[model samples]
Target: MQLCEKYVMQLLGMSFLQYSKTPMNDRWRDKDVTVFTMHDLVHDLARAILADPVNNKGSVVGNGCLYAFLTDCSKPLQLSATSSANIKALHFLDSGKLELRGDAFSLGTCLRVLDLSECLIRKLPESVGQLKLLRFIRAPRIRDQMIPNCITELSELNYLNLRGSHNLSALPESIGGMKGLMHLDLSGCHGIRELPK
Candidate 1:
């Protein structure tokens, strides 16, 4: 255990030694770790690290980390101007309780993938059309909401996932404008009755 701590400290320049508890029982003995909690922690940590301006300046696509997860809906997902400029992918997982701010989409001009699966977001800002580089989107299936026609403006979009979006009754006729699209997943989107010609 000491060896593991030492290795981690050497690698991460920090130590979890102080966080170690119940050394006699291997410290994890009484821990109540769950998959959800662990995922939340990982998401929080990724967001914190990516929020730093230092991580935003480089030309690294997606800041060399293509994924950012915001698991907690109680707090708004706020991205610094620079951080958003460099981010490539973002996920708002199962946040059915929170609404995403409109300005959030305007920041990630270079974003390629956006996952809003099961989120409570009611509308996407017109700025969503400004993300010309975006390639994938996972729109939520909230009944009262509809996907804006501006989504068709993503000419570079390759994948669209509307799985389980039960409330999505229609897609814009302009969807055919996405010439680059290759994969469309409408599984579980029972409300959709027809595809645009």
Candidate 2:
């Protein structure tokens, strides 16, 4: 796995990219070295929590390397490699809020599930649509950068939980366009009144 920092519009200094050298569906057994602030350790821990396939008690659980952490704040790089080169889940638990320190559109091309819970995210970048395989999003406070109508383009999405956004007012009409979605949780979106109709 390789990680890089790159400049992205709207974000000044906190963006990263993840890349892989092989095809997905393979196994990523080699772990890459990453540096984290003591304060940022939780972010990596969060990824480990989500990426772990078995319970610590020794129960075989979910499988997949969907969780990841950001090493650079400028460009995206390979976070890890398994037999599977594609990202299936992501656990971004950085204490810092979600401010694009770099290009918001730099998410890796093969990412799937994304977990940004408990982070400080106010808006999603217009480039979010680039995750063609993204099936899950856990941010509940993304209120800015409208959920691009382009999100409807993601035919693979299944779960969407926006349960604590107090300021969000409405869902993108395009949301109805996500035909593959199986579940949607908007329990905390206080201002939202109706689904896209």
* Among all candidates shown, the one with the greatest lDDT: 1
**Least accurate 10 contiguous residues by lDDT in model 1:** 11-20
Per-candidate Cα lDDT values, in order, are 0.62, 0.55
Model 2 alpha-carbon drift over 4 Å, by segment: 1-67, 71-86, 96-105
TM-score of each: 0.59, 0.56
C-alpha RMSD of candidate 1:
11.4
Error of 2 at 182 (Å): 0.9
- Please give the distance, in angstroms, between residue 99's alpha carbon in candidate 1 and its true position after superposition: 2.1
Instruction: List model 2 lDDT by residue over 8-39, tens digit each.
Output: 21111121222334444324345443232321
Once model 2 is optimally superposed onto the true structure by TM-score, how far is the C-alpha of residue 159 displaced, in angstroms? 0.6
lDDT of 2 at 46: 45
* Residue 167's lDDT in candidate 1: 77
